[model samples]
Target: MEEPGPVHCLLFAEVTPPLIDSHCHLDAAEFDADRAAVAAAAVAAGLATIVIPAIERANFGAVASVCREFPGCVPAYGIHPMYVDRAEPADLDALRATLAREPAVAVGEIGLDRFVEPRDDGRQAFYFVEQLKIARDLGLPVILHVRRAIDPILKQLRRIGVAGGIAHAFNGSRQQADEFIKLGFVLGFGGAMTYPRAARIRELAATLPLEAIVLETDAPDIPPAWRVGARNAPDQLPRIAAELAALRNLPVADIITATTSNVCRALPRLAH
Candidate 1:
């Protein structure tokens, strides 16, 4: 009798779900020269989705255009807190009008920032609140750009009431993380967690419920340790995911499945 052929094991097969780069600024000028190449590299590197957020009203068209060129990229429209100084009252109206016309995945790159000095707190609040109201009115989720202001961010969220979104590059305390989760928000983890000195962030990455965490690159910034001092991109997300798996002592496959699904949870429109 002929020997039986070898049997393949499905149990140990790789669970390489499309890795999601929940946040990336692929439309930034740094990528202007090779943007198409960068997008292709992301796909080849296993990144199935990359959410590009606009930082200012002027770039809204540019960001949307970039997303349109890549099947894997999604556009998020909003004025970042850092750019609130240049924002005019009319821009808020423009944002509202734009949201109604565009297929925006979320109102994003929006939130508080206490880290920068000489900022107009009131102006930042105005844009943030107004944008939050727009997001609520449109029944869309937001992509928060929180920095040294989690409590205030949570406060505004409670006041304006958005449809829940991702807290991009979350660097808050455990209590803050819990609050965000309670409000139906998912925390994005990226290059920061790759730093050995970022003990608190790494701990949160390891201990937080997998369902509450999503992977990101925040590209053109937040480069991983190995790529430190270099321009970051969506291609770095898979390695970042591996770092998270190592931190949690879980298989990378599980991290891929959970984080990929987590992004869809935070931005439900992406589900389509």
Candidate 2:
């Protein structure tokens, strides 16, 4: 039998030394078996911080626990659009209560998703609008999960007039991007750009102003090219940073600094 090909490395040799994963889901069951090890690996790999956004009311406790356990992990709370069908009416109230009691850095993993079929557009919009109110009330930034529903999301945000937040794993038009930026939101980029076919996203990343961009892994989901078939972790941030730098024609350190600062500015609680 032929020997297997040598394993490929993802990171660039002279790129940024440290990078932050502005959004990730470290509380998921995939890491339950060895979450600590995974986190340690990420820290060792130069991942400065990992922001884990809560999916629903059910996982808020787990998300909070992970944040408490991990020194550099920050947690945000919100109901995801894909799971809108599962959210109870009281869940929104619970989210507000949780935000008041818990020490979350933001309100998020919330937004619209028109990609789902037999669409529950009404339900998604209701929850999204409610959470936007919650974020506004609490004076917290929001992390949006917009997918095929940028227009509606933008409209709601404009109407609500919250300060700012992050458009996680942003995949939208340059015009949409500018609107979000104008609203003081930061655009998050992740493994999607690593794909050879995502020319548009790559171009957006290349052209967007550095200050408006934030880095994220969206780990165990949007893995970079080197870890395509495997699970993703915050540790892969260095590689992602390098890719963004290559796209933007800037030094890795510059990308790292800009993204880190942007993340802190976008999510003030992370400053601690």
Pick the TM-score winner.
1
Native-referenced Cα lDDT, model 2: 0.86
In model 1, the runs with Cα more than 4 Å from the true position are 1-16
> When superposed on Cα atoms, how far off is each prediction in RMSD?
9.3, 9.4
lDDT of each: 0.87, 0.86
Q: Model 2 over residues 16-135: C-alpha lDDT tens digits?
A: 444668899999999999999998888678776788899999999999999789867767899999988999989999998888776677798999998988778999999999999989
Error of 1 at 80 (Å): 0.4
Per-residue lDDT tens digits of candidate 1, residues 176-227? Answer: 9999999999999999999999999999999999999999999899999999
Measured against the true structure, the TM-scores of the candidates, in listed sequence, are 0.93, 0.92
